[model samples]
Target: MTTQYAKPLPRVHDLNRAFFLGALDGRLVLQHCDACGHVWFPSAQSCPKCLSQEITWKPVSGRGRVWSWVVMHQRYIPAFADDLPYAVAFVELEEGPFMMTSIVGAEPEDLVCDMPVEVAFDQVTDEVALPKFRPVTGEAS
Candidate 1:
């Protein structure tokens, strides 16, 4: 079953194709620099730490916390009118990268700073699955 995906889609390119593909397969991946042992997201060509080109896509624990969040009171994007007042959050992954994502399986009123969360994939299309998060519960992935 695939979503109709009424919202906009992310552009997949050489640098970020793996990340999107991994999510479609229910895995969370980030860029790892072999030379400097640094990991990051929103994939890049070189390590932000040492500028090393020896990077590989690595799966992460998909565990994180709600660093911060805000309620979308306005329908800035018309497609999201049905989800007005939704929470858009910044998740600090345990692997040390911050991902701007939506918090799911919970209510916006319940969100708090540093709340434990884990990744959940919303398969919008056969090729794209957006990574969202949920409150931690019983060995959350």
Candidate 2:
């Protein structure tokens, strides 16, 4: 039985294919050290702490708050021309990790520190779909 899902993202940065596939499955995957409990994003080969090679993948809640942000008046890529005036933000996940992505579903004037945000996925191309953040319902602040 197949459920509708995101297509696979293109290979980049020599990272593990499983990591990308996990995101396509609508679950956030990150590496955690079995020895020291250290977690790594972008899926490293092993844990950065304690030099442990015993790392495993785990799903995390995609909830976070807006830690910082910037309003981009110009598109660095032509593909993003239509998305001009977007807010690029760094969200510090409640799980204790920081992710850099665009903030959606809210106006620039409404974005502020510690604003409640939730993850939303967007298929930017046939190969890659990104996880972005949007303001949580009724939490406009």
By TM-score, who's the top model here? 1
Expressed as tens digits, the lDDT of each residue in 28-59 for candidate 1 is 99999999899997788899999999998989
Estimate, for each residue in 72-112, the C-alpha lDDT of model 2 and write its tens digit: 88867676677678888999887778888888888887899
Worst 10 residues of 1 by lDDT: 132-141
In candidate 2 the C-alpha lDDT for residue 83 amounts to 69
Q: Give residue 91's lDDT in candidate 1 (0 to 100).
A: 99
Off by over 4 Å in 1: 1-3, 138-141
What TM-scores do the predictions have?
A: 0.94, 0.82
Q: Candidate 2, after superposition: displacement of residue 124 in Å?
A: 3.6
lDDT of 1 at 12: 93
Error in Å for residue 140 of model 2? 7.7
Whole-model Cα lDDT of every candidate shown, in order: 0.92, 0.77
